[model samples]
Target: MKFDKSELQIFANYCVAAAESMAYTLVRTAHSTFVKETEDFSCALASVDGLTFASPRTFGATWYVGLDYGPVIRSLTDYQPGDVCMTNDPYSGFVATHTPDVVMWKPVFYEGEIICFVAGHIHNTDMGGAVPASLSRTLTEIHQEGIRFPPTRIVDKGELNETLLSWMMCNVRAPEQNIGDMKAQIACLTTGERRVLEIVERFGVDAFKAGIGQLLDYSESQSRAVAKTIPDGRYFFAEYVDEDAVGGKPMRIALTLTVDDGLLQFDFSGSDPQLTSSLNVPTGGHPRHALLLVGLNYVLYSLNPEIFLNAGMLRIATCEMPVGSVLNPVEPAAVGMRSLTCVVVQAAVFGAFAQALPDRMPACPASSVCLLNVKTTDTSGRTIMASIGPVGGGAGGSSAGDGSDASGANMAFLRNTPVEINEAEVPIRIQEYGLVADSGGAGQYRGGLAIVMEFKVFAPNTLVTARNRDRTLFGSWGIKGGRAGRTSLFVRNPRTADQDILGNTDLVACQPGDVIRLEGNGGGGYGAPFRRTVEAVERDVRRGYVSRQEARERYGVVYEDGRVNAAATAALRADMAEGPVEANAFFDYGPNRSAHEAVWTRERYVALCQCLETVSVGWRFFLKHQMFDRLAERIAEGEPIDGVQIVFDLFAELKAQFPALAAQQARIKQVA
Candidate 1:
């Protein structure tokens, strides 16, 4: 190590301060409500090799601490002193996870030598696409998502490329907002460059370079030290997204976390193939990609809060994603809703780690965040596109205490926009916005309650896209003997004669006076509900977080006249304790999942995967959907399902249905 402990600490603080300053500049000067208020952006200082060493710790999204800019950096040619490169293409280097997340980076030079790079990304509200927000689960391909920008120099030698800038703005709905946000990003990078130069001037170029390397090494050591705390073993867990596409069946994401000594490997081999929706995650096969390790980052921070936030933390971990899988989809595959898929990945990682450390881990959080966007017209009839803030649900309960209410948990970095801001910006009326009672799962450490948001739009033909609306069919799973959380609900014209229930539907068309109500899923509980004290249940009822009926039924605690009946509660708990126990009491995946799994057993899924592997990437989702439909029909008729034989039969039928696949039927049959 070139620098001593004290010297390295000072250098690290300086770098962090620089990154934080960049974030401050961006948040204060940004135009969009998503950026200035919701805070869905990040800033970091990376090494010359594009390894993030320092990022804003207390501001913006925490999902990019280990974001690698190396791919985007190497994609471009020789960099001038003031060259600022940009890219939003998911297939190009995987730096920008989706089209809406516009990423930009500027090189910092000292004495004709590159010292470091300043980089960050902001979530644009609109980027011309099929939907208003450029994101929807219904979108089938990347072309439908939005226009993409590959790695190129948006700012060449400190001068803005007017042609490139104009070309980008001409394609989006809100050109003014997008241009303002882009300029704010450039300003942020400029702030970072100045700060980096200051550090080099204060510490000398030699010490600054040496100290940066030592800081990464120190962070790597901290991560390894935390890994040593957990027992070395393989922990496997699987989670599901409510829908594969619009009105589609549930999709599975399997993870096997292998912890050997101080090293960790996330294997996504048994996961489902790429979907025909925008929920795919474009990782580009990078082992330490930010999307794959987003969940791991939260886990490491929860285990040891002192661990440094940088690419070094991911040094102890690597990822194995099957090619053509949801996590590593091929080019042209839609990835607008990758954030939603990443949440499921987080839940799977959390589930896997719970087995390794049951006492310390928390139950599943509300694995969904509904990002609502409104496209309406004013009185003059001009098109107006606005984002109505992200309404996320509660976090799961842990040993420490109850989970947080209305928080995104792992994605808590996405700050919510105030109702005042939303109403003031867009022509909409905010009706009801509060917590839902009895939605949280009951346990010793009770889960957090869900959120309810209802709003009315006055304009007719108002288009609303609620991307990432999930948990409508299956709720968040609980751990130990705790109960599962409640499922989400989305409705139009609620409590009216023309009310309509929409389940996991992302796009909606509304008429005047139509009220849209969206209720997010609650967080799962930890430990046993019977173990929760009577006082906790009574307090929850008094606070309106839990209903009196829920207290009596779920928690086995009786409440009379706004007070707990001690004698009755004790008797009810005793009676509940004597009831039949679940076979695998570790996880409580609600009745919906339990029933679905009963029909589609693990053996059936294994057989289905075997059949899928025999088909091409383009035909996998098509064949999977056909098999699912056939299985549902057979189950409804009470007919026995031969899982293995059914897969082969479906393949043969599909081959005959499509003449293009007819020639490959023989090869498929031979492989099967």
Candidate 2:
């Protein structure tokens, strides 16, 4: 069968429709709330070479699309009909599908030759790990996190591999749900395989392959055209994660973007060293995960919204990550909570582009994905567990307008998980859920507002895992004179009763009637608050996104009786003098790269990072911070007046004296 241009277009549409249909089936039949309600899954078709050919237009996987399935595809070369290759090892190329996501890949054959691959990924409720839910911020290694599968064939020649199935069942806590979802993913791929074969039968294999190439080529061309429109230049930006979760040491993410001649390069050479925490990112030919940058770029450019997301879009871009860094961790590194790092990575990219294209880019958005896992037992003493929908932060203010309320920047497509579903599934009650008024940064174009959610635990010994609790110092920073957004707050109660502040944790056992309130961070504002129009301030007050006090203090506008007091506002504005914008007032988790440079001196901090290359991942995080803190303490004590350089020099000398450590340092430097 041969497909002409017209037929090729029709076939392409059909393929996209098939993928969407498969996703719909999985969602309707899936067991988890993350999949059914939040829709945190994706299905796509890949060429025999592992390049994505077609993906669903509606649903987006965090790090699954734009991925090259070469490793998984190659592992399944011997696979016959009915064979399914499955893996969630972030290191082997399935980047950070560590838990929740069980990826399934099935090869489509034509005339006894592999022609295409159908892959579907769904977020399972749980995969066996140390914690009840899969995400553990304290996981130090992959073994402690969950079951590991290297590109193994779970189904052979249409037969289920009972040995592998048994192993999975033994490992996971919710074996039934996991296995059921696994079968659901397989069914999705099977649907895609059937659709692809139908197209192959209608159009000859040669024409089908040609259409794939044409579609890829078209996407590549459009991406390059958009890239060319932006002025070619180099941009540098950095963002920090408050900590690595297990420890209080801030992690640095430095990015340099060099765009020239329609080619964009992202270099992540100066990122912080990998930690023992579960925040590490696994590395492989992660084309899909890496294409997160490309997807973000597309959203920023607001290009033709439909380029048919494929591997071709990445042809105009490339990413350079240093091995053993947090962004590209080595083997055995835990990545259970990798999405936390991804939010920061995306912000770093946005920050870099903001430096280059401030007019086109908006101020920094509140970039935290709040995941809360509630675990308890039912009346029968059977364990009951549920993962609440991940809460999204507000979008940053853009040049044209202020940010929206309780929305994510660059990812406005995602929606909040409904309270009804949450109430029905978990042992909790939603006391209050709404937007945090006056949380958005004040400016001419204010940033989006953050969300406020309060929940009461109904079961005894309920375990709760709340990540990214506060964003005060770590909250999104504004550009120009725009003020930073209010940092996130996790409080038990406020102004009335005893309330405990929550920290990022692997688990928290709670008693019944304990209330947990989450106040998310808002995005940074774009321009001066006083410059904002009176009408905008009035609108914010009416909408309950801003209070009258904020209107007068921040925006220099007065609101009375739901109307802006124009004369008072003018007088306030006239009385206010141009001054430095308020700096970010938030908690510093620990010594960030910037703070390290500032507090310990840039040269000293650089020397410490160099020394860190010599030590093991575990020891470096433990000893270096202690040593730096000790040195700072000594300095504060006025102990090193005469022999300051000697003290530093002696420490360096001792580090160099260890031959094994020196050799390890050499190896690390060579690898880096």
- Point to the candidate with the largest TM-score: 1
Query: Which regions in candidate 2 have their CA more than 4 angstroms from the true location?
Result: 1-11, 60-63, 285-301, 410-415, 467-472, 493-496, 560-563, 575-577, 581-608, 614-619, 631-672
Number of clashing pairs per prediction, in order: 0, 7
Residues 1-672 of candidate 1: C-alpha lDDT, one tens digit per residue = 388878787889999999999999999999999899989999999998999999998789989999999999888878899888899999999999899999999989898988889999999999888888999998999999888999999999988999998988889998999999999999999999999999988989998888877888988999899888888999988889988998898899889899999899999987889999999999988998998898889999998898778999999999999789899999889999999999999999999999998998999998788988999998889888878888778889888888899887877468888899989888999999999887787888888888888999999999998989899988888898888888899999998888999988888999898999999889999988988887887788889998888888989988777667889999999998998999999999999989888876766777777777766788888888998897787778998767567667766777678887765755766877
User: Could you tell me the C-alpha RMSD of candidate 2 in Å?
Assistant: 3.9
Error of 2 at 557 (Å): 0.9
On the 0 to 100 scale, the lDDT of residue 276 in model 2 is 79
TM-score, structure 2 vs. true: 0.90
Candidates' C-alpha lDDT = 0.88, 0.71
TM-score of each: 0.97, 0.90
- What candidate 1 gets wrong by more than 4 Å, as runs, is 642-662, 665-672
Q: Candidate 2, overall lDDT?
A: 0.71
Residue pairs in clash, model 1: none
